[model samples]
Target: MATQTSIPASHDRDFYAWALESANRLRAGNLAGLDLQRIAEEIEGMGRAEKHALASHLKILILHLLKWRYQPTLRSLSWQLSIANARDEIAELLEDSPSLTGKLPEILARRYPAARQGAILETGLPAATFPTGCPLTVEQLLDPEYWT
Candidate 1:
């Protein structure tokens, strides 16, 4: 059995130390000494981080698709590579957290506007050049062979 330290690690002051100590307590079955509230919050934070990662990758894929469709003259291997990479990342995230598949519609709805604005900014094209909303479905956005 691991002995508890006289004082608990401060979560805010030193997060790495707190995490290590928490892990030690858990390994030792010292539930009474565990910081349950902060541990729960940290676990929830991890889930939110995964969700944000999915949204970010979705935005990148959508932005590249918009660029590919609206600015064919400006297309480069960089854009194609980015689109491919985003699809791979999204696939990995879904594999790791299958429940996140249910969140795709919400993620797309929230990320598409940002992606559209990004396309306008990155391409210096008029906002009118891009559609007001995403024209593609999640399936199309993630399709490895779907190039517009």
Candidate 2:
């Protein structure tokens, strides 16, 4: 039998090594060997990452929708593809973490202002061109057919 080499739990030095070691330690039933604090932090960090990703994709999707609706003359394949890609990514995230679906309304509401500003900046349109609040519903944002 090959002896499994153990890695040091130094999160600051080598996170990849630490993660691998943590998993190995966990599989070996060595709870005492685990870096409890760091592991907890990493787990929490993962949830935060998922939320951040959801927010980012939502922002991009909203930004593109804004552009598509307000700047019809400037529409391109890129914007359409961006909208599709963001939706696909968000769908995948939700599929993997259904619990996040419940958080969508809040995430969208929080992310919309930034997306609206992004649309303004990208479209070179006045802030007034876009609604102060998101005009699209969560359903419309996710529905592939809504804007098409």
Candidate 3:
């Protein structure tokens, strides 16, 4: 019988190796739909260290998705890339500094306090009225009265 070990199998392999292999496979030219659930499960099973190594690779994957989905301009792409890099750096910093985790709640509260309640107006706006003269705008130009 195999003994149960606290150390998971993913930890047995070097994180860089696993991350690189996973990224290479993901980046390989393929048009077929991916099994996202299965891929997520596989990543979830990885050890903490592996997860950290994989963050950068995952960031790249997200950037690719953003680029494809939005077809952003080069300037927009550069800005987004910078933001992604900053996010990855923050993740690395948090992972390396475990002590920061303890103060996360306080830090978050300080950075973003709870939303304040605001009173809502119950009054409704009056219906809009069109100008008496012939509508010069496209919307008015298309009106039946303008055509008549």
The numbered model that scores best in lDDT is 1
lDDT of each: 0.93, 0.91, 0.38
Q: What is the TM-score of each candidate against the true structure?
A: 0.90, 0.91, 0.24
Residue 95 lDDT (model 3) = 77
Error of 2 at 83 (Å): 0.3
- Alpha carbon RMSD to native, model 2: 2.9
Clashes of 3: 0
lDDT tens digits, residue span 1-148, model 1: 9997667779988899899989998989999967798899999999999999999999999999999999999899999999999999999999999999999999999999999999999999999998887899989987899999
Q: What's model 2's lDDT at 74? A: 87
Candidate 1 residue pairs that clash: none
Candidates, ranked, lDDT: 1, 2, 3
Model 1 residue 2 distance off true place after TM-score fit, in angstroms: 21
lDDT at 107, model 1: 97
Pairs of residues at least 3 apart in sequence or in different chains that clash in candidate 2: none
> In candidate 1, what residue range of length 10 has the lowest lDDT sum?
4-13
lDDT of 1 at 4: 75
Better by lDDT, candidate 3 or 1:
1
Error of 1 at 5 (Å): 7.2
Q: Alpha carbon lDDT of residue 66, candidate 1?
A: 96
